[model samples]
Target: VLDRIYDFERILTRIETGTVSPKDLVALRESLAVIPQLKQVLSGASADLLHSLNDRLQTHDDVYDLLCRGIKDEPGLVIRNGGVIRDGFSPELDEIRSIAANSHAFLQELEEKEREKTGIKMKIGYTKVFGYYFEISHANTKPIPDYYVRKQTLVNAERYITPELKEFEVKVLTSQERMLALEYKLFGDIRRQIQGHIPAMQETARAIARIDCLYSLACAAYDNRYVRPSLNTKATISIKDGRHPIIEKYLKDELFVPNDVTLNHEDHEILVITGPNMAGKSTYMRQVAVLVLMAQAGSFIPAKEGSICPVDRIFTRIGASDDILTGQSTFMMEMKEVSYILKHATSRSLLILDEIGRGTSTFDGMSIARAVIEYCLKHIHALTLFATHYHELIAMADDSPKIKNYTVAVKERGKNIKFLRRIIPGGADRSYGLHVARLAGLPESLLKRADVILEDLEKNGGAPVPAKAPVNPAPSPMGDSLFSSPVIDKLLSVDVSSMTPIEAISFLYNLQKDAKEGSGIQ
Candidate 1:
């Protein structure tokens, strides 16, 4: 049984790697399901061989049957020494000969009796090669030669008769010819039946392939020391030393770095991961998602013996892109994804949001990020790993008991950043974007300019503020016109502190419209 499981694993790996199609995977799965039942009938190595043969036979039976049905009309076809034989004398040849002779004689007598009663002249000829003889019953009795009887009987280079038994031979040949034609009709019927059911046959084959794939996956999981992780009605994800199987395989010589993460019903439901760019935060989040999926799908996960409370759904919002053609900025796309996750994710779900709200201005992005964390904590109640550069979010751990803060550790030396790629219990010091920029080949002059701009921006309270209006302004009708539009009214009514990330977006759009309409407020 264990060995069978191993075989099943290999089959599934092939499927995962695209070496086998889904149809083949289904067949393999069905074969694995039968392995346990077949174990009792054969023992030891014999059992293994039998199981292997059964799998092959199940897979190839359709093709073999199609070929056999094509030739069924040729009556002499039979199994000989485990191989197919067509029309050759054998040990059972005498018995077949007797049956053919009797059949022909009966037909000949019937023909003669009918002709006598009707006053119609009829001629019957029999031969062994034709399998039966033919009966001629026509009013125009043309001169029939000896060669005519022999020529009609010959088919595919085999002689129909011997001279010694030529008379009987022609009669038998005629009868055989009639029988063969009838057999051919029956063969056509069978072929039609197969053709009609081709769709169903293909479906069944695909189903079997899926079964084979499952069996193989199960087997491989067993071999790799993989086990089914636990799941509960509550939302919780916990894993120890879990490695991403695909990434590990690609690394080849390098050892895979393992990470441990835990989200539970009591202590923590949300984890805010803050780390420098490229420090494995996203990879860690993805690993957890993949493990949950694997466990729910009934396959062993790549972990050093871990347990997970089953997730109803998995959502990942990891990358950034602008919808320029759609007239949506990068921030709009980010808000759209964030809104989707918050709306759809449930307590039994797992959410991975990497760098959410990073596309907007610092204050707006930080405010939006704060509200998102709060919503997940207070409303969705799902297990979440929120990876971000917003260090302010780390404070949520102090305020909310359900939120825990974590960071992927990075070693900083003077002006350099060295990614450790290991998760640790704390918050990140900074985003280190400049260090990464340097590594990306940013010119020294550009870095210097960026530093100068950063200093000026920090001195002016992080962002530029408009100069205050003159104290002695008396409002005219035109000045009042600046703030009277519907768009401006809606923007003024929006309260960012109270609204979630999604609501803030609607407010931002209304504000933008107000600005476009010659409103004074920006």
Candidate 2:
């Protein structure tokens, strides 16, 4: 019924136009006309909430009747026109309009009487620049009547104003002006009466908005075959046959493969998901988070069966983005978000950290990923889904019983691989990055070169270090070459891991100064 309500916003806008339109007045009347029916239906509803809402809605009968009797059904757009007000709404305004209607005939009759009295070829004419004037030929100026006062002189005639003409002009113009003024005044009165019901209308609007949102959600769930999930305070989440709601909604050909997920505080607090790109790692984690959020929000989840632990907060560090203008690199931004999660997350929180340390070198990133997983398991104990391509993180499960390893299953065909899109209890054997790269249209020669590098690294365990470049010979102060000094070499080789951030900065500054001084470069 609320959805059927039309032109409410347009009516409000026309009120803001100050000089309200007849069409807008009629629109407001139509909207107000629906309120009585709405209130009656709501009042008769069996639900207590509906009954209470009905108590708050105003019918505004006086305003409605005023508008219905005053404004015409098809009142034209502007208010200045004479037909804007109905005939019987205002007697005084009607009388003024009647006088205005006969104004032309009255002026004609007065012109003829004046012409006979003056007898000097006088004629009455009207112009916007000069209201009503009597024109007398210049040849008859000597016999110009004393009653006529010259207003303007033309080439062959003198334009003159008479007291009778001025009085008639005031009566005609005043009547038309007052009629318009009265119509505007009546419209304002009706608009203000409607404005008085604003508080009730606002309340009704809020209730309708909430109802509309819930109805939309229910419709979506029904159309997509969703089920309601049970929510609890167990600090654990378990879902069976879960699928990504949005992805499933848009899938055209192949059926979306559903996956299962389990998270608890004691044994499986952290699931380190490892898989090749596009193998459904991110999608699975996101599905779990979405189901939990939906359950807590009192909406159905897109799953066969599910139970959610009501999470206090959900922290997602999913995508890669940076604040480059603020001088924060991508890695720094990632670390900052990580820091925020660590500081704010509680045991009851849900954390979805995807590619946590991916913005830096492999070893540094892997090390950070390991530390974050350990901290979440040992300190926070939050139910966390940590998805990454850093396959080495799977090793954390061996030492920590709270950590679990999961992977998206993949099947390899001759030179091509198919993503199974299945989550299972085990670490991924290997990331098929090369296969993904090939799929991404990498050149065959580049793929072969990468294959050679991978084979060599597999044989040697790691890349071999490059040989150091020869140092440039230069003058040194302190009676010795700085590059050859044992003290300088030891200083350069000191363990930086033991230094704090401030201490490291100071050490770097002092080292640069010392090198400059020793090389005699000032």
Candidate 3:
């Protein structure tokens, strides 16, 4: 019924032209027909909103009844055809239809009887120029009756028409013509009668549309176990155990870990989120934005409990996207969006920024990112969720009470790291980009070389390490790194089982000699 209801405004607009088509009128009737069912559906609801919507709706059975009685059950797209109006609705129309139906039936009977008697297999046919006649093929030499008056001749057959058949043909053709004209007139009357109820029906359409939206929202809330988030006009947002509405839905065979978020006009205005790649930092930030928007728009949120206030607008600078149409690089687009946000955002606005100033050189990117964060904290003061890999900026949180440091927790297990996907207090100190690459299936040889380079960077500023330490150091829990030095690395790489006794003696002599001299150990 809802699908059948066409645009009510279209009906109203068309009536100004003085007539509505049968298709439009049928659509209008369906629009009215569903109103009673809608009211009944809402009748048992306790919500005053649903009750108010139900009150706006009425049965409109008068319109439905008029249409049911006047129009054909399967009234086609046109009114000019004869079947558009129901039979027996009009006495004159029924009389005309009866004449046409009975005439056609009689002609069929006459054709069959003559075929049996004459055994010529004759068939009744009609033409515009030749009215009605019986056709017999040249192959049939059997005789026809005396009443079969000659009419016309074909190249291979005889054509004849009985006086009785000729009389009924006139009645059939004329009644059919009158029947179509009458149906067109009757369909017009129905369309005009509906025009009088256009205002009421359009109002009801609005009510039905509202009810449909609310009902769908209710169903989603019930099915997804969504909680109702409280909404207010203040500039505070606090959500406990908040899950990403979208990401949680697609997590197969694994559960989504929900995180808590808190933001206010003052102290907790901006969050500097730092975490390793794929640690759910982006997911966490986006959920805070999504939940706030949902709550403000009167929707239940995907959280245990939340209290959100309406923001003037929500601005985002998320992920890597280039505007190829305008020849803008990803960094250029990032800057443009950030510029706009900084220019317009008020304290009440919400901003979800992921990796701002990430597309340039490391120092430049870090500087720009820091400047942007500072501007947002001191100037815009908007509620912000800023996710970045730049651990250097975590210090900003220490300086200002408005900015707070948060990280998605990570756990190191032996040589591998596991992303816990939990956001907690304190900033992440390392990115673990190599670990993420390992998970993404980088070559082991390349990863080993990269790990060596990273170790060098952290240890000796990427310079070549000497053979060994100048002095002995304490043993470590981290798998004997002192013995795994460059000299020891070569030692471990050798196949000791394959070495001859003489070769093993030679290798031991070289190591002892290298250990005595500072550079010989290499």
Candidate 4:
């Protein structure tokens, strides 16, 4: 019933302006009539908010019944019309209608008598151009009655008006016009009375709106099997069996795998998650953030269990998107989002980043990612979840006490890979990017070639060098020769900072010449 309330302001406006239609009046009455029952139901509510709203509600039974009795059961739209008001509402209106009914019968009888008296097939007609006139054909123009005054002439006919007809038209039109004026005045009075109660109706509407919202949230929790989460101010968020609320709902055939998350400002402020492409690292990170958001919003969280310290802000840099019209590339947009997060995130904030710095080359991207992780762990101390393909970043756990390493588990068959979607302790040993590519339908020849190149890279500690390419140049003769010079030893041991600029330059020039001569290069 509360949810059914809409367009109430429209009703109040129409009533205030004396333009209240039958439908608006009926809707208003129906809404007000439901108030007493609504109050009764709310009075028994367990929540204090609902009970308080019940006390604030005003039923206004007088106004409700006024609309019920004063207006017809199914009144027409216009109030100036007679059909708008009920028959018994006004004695004056009823008497006028009775006179008008008798007048209609009288006019019909008068037309029949005139037709018999003249025997010229006379007809009674009314039109806005000429009211209550008798139309006669031209062939019957002979022996016309003088009492019938000619009013209008047509090509083959003539129209005439009689004094009796004129008097009857005046009485009928006068009564109808007077009755309509009375009806309009009466309906306007009733609408004005209802308008006075608009404030109370608005208040009731507000209370019902709040109740509807609460009911909707409750329904979501119940239908989705969510549990209430514990909240505190301790700067920690921990959840057991946490699953992505939205993803889990859309999943078919396979159930979502739940994972555990733990983060605290003191010891484990930042968690570095590494795994293959589809191993659920991003999903696990997002689940933690969602649970935190829900708990802060005072709604039940979609987790088996959760206890979260309220975060001041939640920031995410998860997916890749470009603002093409705004002239920002994907990498630039990613950096902009990262910059905002780093600038605003506090110790009580929750930050979720996925594949940060992945838009650049391997070495540069890894370097930047490592620096960002260090900054967050050392300076911000925010509860952070970072999912990345950079497995080397997991080694930061050895240096930073607040950095923890975790990985999504996977199973490797002989030639196939299976994603377990489970977060486990420690860094992932391998990334399985090629396996993911294979799953994505990469050609077998390409996969095999990639495997060979990867083997060469591992052997050479970098990208593979061509088999025909010359090996590393023999050790530089300058290395052993320069070491044998006493001047070199002296130069290495000297406090160059203490020397004047000229003296330092002179020493450097002589040393370079001697080193070149000693190596037999000059």
Would you give me the overall lDDT of model 1? 0.65
lDDT of 1 by residue, 1-522 (tens): 323322433444443443533233343444445544444433343445345544532333443344443332223432221122223323243234444758556566755764565444545554444543334433335543354344352333222223434544454545455444544444334335445544444444444455555667767787666766776655667888888867766776567788998998577788999988877898899998888888887678888877777777899898988889989988898899989998999988889999888897888889999999899888888888899999878988999888888998888898688887789988976788888888899999999877677667768867774554799987653345446667567757767699988888877876666555553543
lDDT of 4 by residue, 326-366 (tens): 99999899999999999999988899999999998878889
10 residues in a row with least lDDT, candidate 3:
475-484
Per-residue accuracy of model 3 over 273-385 as CA lDDT, tens digit each = 99899999988988898888788777898889998989999998997889999999999989998999899999889999899888998778999999999898888889999
Deviating ranges (above 4 Å) for candidate 3: 1-31, 70-85, 89-101, 106-129, 133-196, 456-522
lDDT measured at residue 328 in model 3 versus the true structure, 0 to 100: 100
lDDT of each: 0.65, 0.81, 0.83, 0.84
What TM-score goes with each of the models? 0.56, 0.70, 0.70, 0.69
TM-score of 3: 0.70
Model 2 off-target regions past 4 Å? Answer: 5-130, 133-195, 464-522
The candidate maximizing lDDT is 4
